[model samples]
Target: MIESHNTKGLIFNVQYYSIHDGPGIRTTVFMKGCPLKCLWCQNPESQRLQREIFFELEKCTGCGICVQACSEGAIELFEGRSRTNRKKCSGTGRCAEVCPVEARKIMGRSVTAKEVFEEVARDALFYQRSGGGVTLSGGEPLAQPRFAVSVLKLCKDAGIHTTVDTCGYASWDTVQQVLSYADLVLYDFKHIDPAEHKRYTGVSNELILDNARKIYHELAIPMLARVPIIPTYNDSADNIKATTQFISSELGKNIKVHLLPYHRLGETKYERLEKMDLAVLIEPPAEEQMLALQEIVQSFGLEAVLGG
Candidate 1:
């Protein structure tokens, strides 16, 4: 949260009955904005601090509805999706206003906590039938610690299982507050090397590791460390060993470590934001390579989950 204010699930996306995020079927709330810019990010739309407009090039009929709706002339026709000059846009909610077909659209919307709980409550029966609840994911849920804590506490009050999928880059105090109401913490550790971590993700891992260590002192809840195995980034044999050794010695082997195979799911989102071109970036890791890495995790006496 760049600026903390009490908010509901900021960007709610109901992923019905999924077994992967956590125990049983779960609903994951996709929060927006992240401190890290991992090269293999799969949800690029959730990378901004505010609701941003993106062009659905395939859905556009060239109706020019967006152009007519732009109050600041921020949107204009381009090679494909409307060329959005985000530098000048005020986030006025105008360009996406008049688009009838949703060619011009926003990725996320702010929802009140009560309203969000109502949506989650819709699956209360499912949660009760099977031990599944809500999973708060990112961009980085801790980024909006206040609202996230509210929602997590609300879920705990309602007897809903709460899990936070975070990079663990926040302050230990905030992390402790959020974890107080969470039943599980899916912490992320991409690269352990501080220099290389900064080079790619734009942030050092020192704070992240510090928070994780401190949070583990009151480790009453279950936590799983998720590592996104990026080829040529943190996939080397030495990196895996260092990460596994650290987790084993610091967080303990009881805390599981999972391997998330990088994918191109959010490749199109980069084009929509016009942030930077990554088409020439490295490809996803091969399945065989993924299994090999999983074996390494097992070697460190930890169970390895293939993909998240």
Candidate 2:
């Protein structure tokens, strides 16, 4: 059902040598766009499907150069400073190119599967030495299903291990396409309750939970469940217990669960993207709390690992 093509995908960053996304040291291709609007998203720039301009007010020197460079008249001076009228911006990136201090930046760019493969292949030596490979991360890797499958196929064809770190919110067909090439799948679980999940992620967890079960029972892909232990969100002992129970009972497989501690690392990124409302000032779960949650999962006869 999966077919490989030369389709292009919108991506924000091609992170080289990431040890956290998957096993060993791997190159993480961060695709732009997501189905969820989690308030605590670390990469706010990846949330939008389209290319966006991030203007840093501190870096701007009140220069009108961007105004002159924008062909769509997207920029203008307001209250003695240049402000980008996003509605008028065409995303041509000319304003970013003309900026003197890099105050204006384009967040996403379109790239073909071949181009991505070539860039990631530069780390072949590292992948070979560390038992590492390529990982497709998001926004939701399956959000751009065609590009994700193509990239995964390319890596696997080259005899490299592949992993897909997804939020598990795509169609079964799309998920199957990614599974066709991925050696491992890193599935993200936010909340066990559907109402709570919709409140936090702005999407019902029905699709996500259903997809996870299908991946486990039908495809039987070697998968790891990753949970972001956020404070005041799903960090309650009751919630953790429910999660472990669901994993053990529903999936019916003894799979290891990775508990990711929520951190404030993505706070600044929201500010940079001018989406500070999405930034939540929450503290990372304490070490004691993380360990306690790990114990809960282990109590259910499963291995629980802290972090990726």
Candidate 3:
């Protein structure tokens, strides 16, 4: 069992009043680090396990405040723009703290489970009123098994409904440990074909599929499968049908399948993080396409809903 008192987790964001994650008016805690490198990933900053500096070139005025604040000499002004030497930057966030403009920002933070629990508990009234509670999301929450379990346990102990939004790629033991405290599981089923899955997400779907099957058969917890409909990726009719069929046969028809449409919301994030946006040219699935996929899921006797 994981201890909750002093366990610390690296979290990238804690989104409150989220209606799309799980149930009504929930808080989604975005943990740092992930095993898969999905091409259409929205949160690029969440991929790394440590704190990162996000520099917006347009917002930077080359004031040298960040340059002066950075004791490690990680920042330099070149042609009226502040550049960051990521390797030299210690992720101390001092440069961000001293920056006048909001150009410099830190991406992740380490917080105790107790601190997270307290913050989440603040919305207890809202959760109780709306049948919503707390959701542990990623950069696969299962990647930080102990911290995820700690936070979930604390929330569950306080009579708050807890949900784990995971990629379902972890070992069965890790999945079992975290799910023991989760009220619901928002599992991501990217692609049914293992090679295609690896081609797009940088990982095979074998372990993810196996873990999902085990979670359904071994655990009594309710699960909702989420699929991101990325263009030229896993948005094909064949992939959708195969995914829905697997969900219906292996995971049971009662499970709801959410077809999430891909968006370019994270395009700017890639620019800030200086990472390649592979899906930059890929457009979101059209409404008609989403509806068609939903129909396909319904054909397998499974409930399919567009968006979270």
Candidate 4:
């Protein structure tokens, strides 16, 4: 039992009433920081551990309020547009505070486990009625093991079903810590091939696959394999077949596979975070393509569902 409710962790969002994350309407707590740098990451702002500024160019009116608010002089008008010198800016959120149109915003916040749990518990009535609970999502929940454990433990103590959504890139010990409290695990299976996985997510799938096996065979936890069907990446029939076969042979046939179709929803987030949208040109998988992949997954005698 985690006795400390004061352990601080960085989190970006607390989304309530989310149906896709777990069994029912869930409140997904998006933790800050991630080890994997996937090309098609939906939460680019969640990549960094510390608080960062989000400057929406279209929302800025070039009124120079943020310029005067920033003590570091990080903000300067460049042709009637506010530009930030990220190196000079310390993410103090002073500029974001004074932005009239809400163009400038800070991405993440530091909060205690108790504080987060209190907010999560606010939606207990909704969770009870819908058979939903709280989900710990990324950046990668296991990246901050202690904080994740604290939050999960708090939810579990309160009788809220806990789920950990992870990339399966963390250590076995970290996975064990989270699993101690998590009722379910949503593990991301990016690609079957390690080389391709590394090429895309900047990490090998060797540890991920190994962790999946450990979690399934050793821990015997309720697990769901979530595969994001990218158009030109991991959507091929060969990769899909390999993924299903691995689950059937290594992990068990009872595990359900969620076939998630990749979308450009996070593309605009890159603009706000001042990062490049690497997969901007990539289109979402067609409906027919997703259905075909579902067929391949079901062919392995595994239940496959489209979207979370």
Q: Compared to the true structure, candidate 4 yields what TM-score? A: 0.96
True-vs-predicted CA distance for residue 299, candidate 1, Å? 1.2
List pairs with backbone clashes in candidate 3.
none
Q: Given candidate 3, what's the lDDT at residue 265?
A: 87
The top-ranked prediction according to lDDT is 4
For 231-278, candidate 3 gives per-residue lDDT tens digits of 898899999999988999888889999999998888888889866535
**Per-residue lDDT value at 85 in model 4:** 86
Worst 10 residues of 1 by lDDT: 1-10
Off by over 4 Å in 2: 1-5
- Per-residue lDDT tens digits for candidate 2, residues 155-231, read 88888889999999978888877787888889898999999999999999999889989999889888898999989
- Please give the CA lDDT of all the candidate structures: 0.79, 0.87, 0.90, 0.91
Write the residue-wise lDDT of candidate 1 on 1-308 in tens digits: 22222465457255778777888778888888787887777787777767777766777777667777778888787765467788877677776777777766676788866666666777888888889999988788887777887777677788899888989887777887778878888889889889988988889999999888877767566888899888888898788888988888888789788898877776777777676665336688999998988888899899888887
Clashes of each: 3, 0, 0, 0
**Model 4 lDDT-worst window of ten:** 273-282
TM-scores of the candidates in the order shown: 0.92, 0.95, 0.96, 0.96
**Candidate 2, run of 10 with poorest lDDT:** 1-10
Off by over 4 Å in 3: 276-279
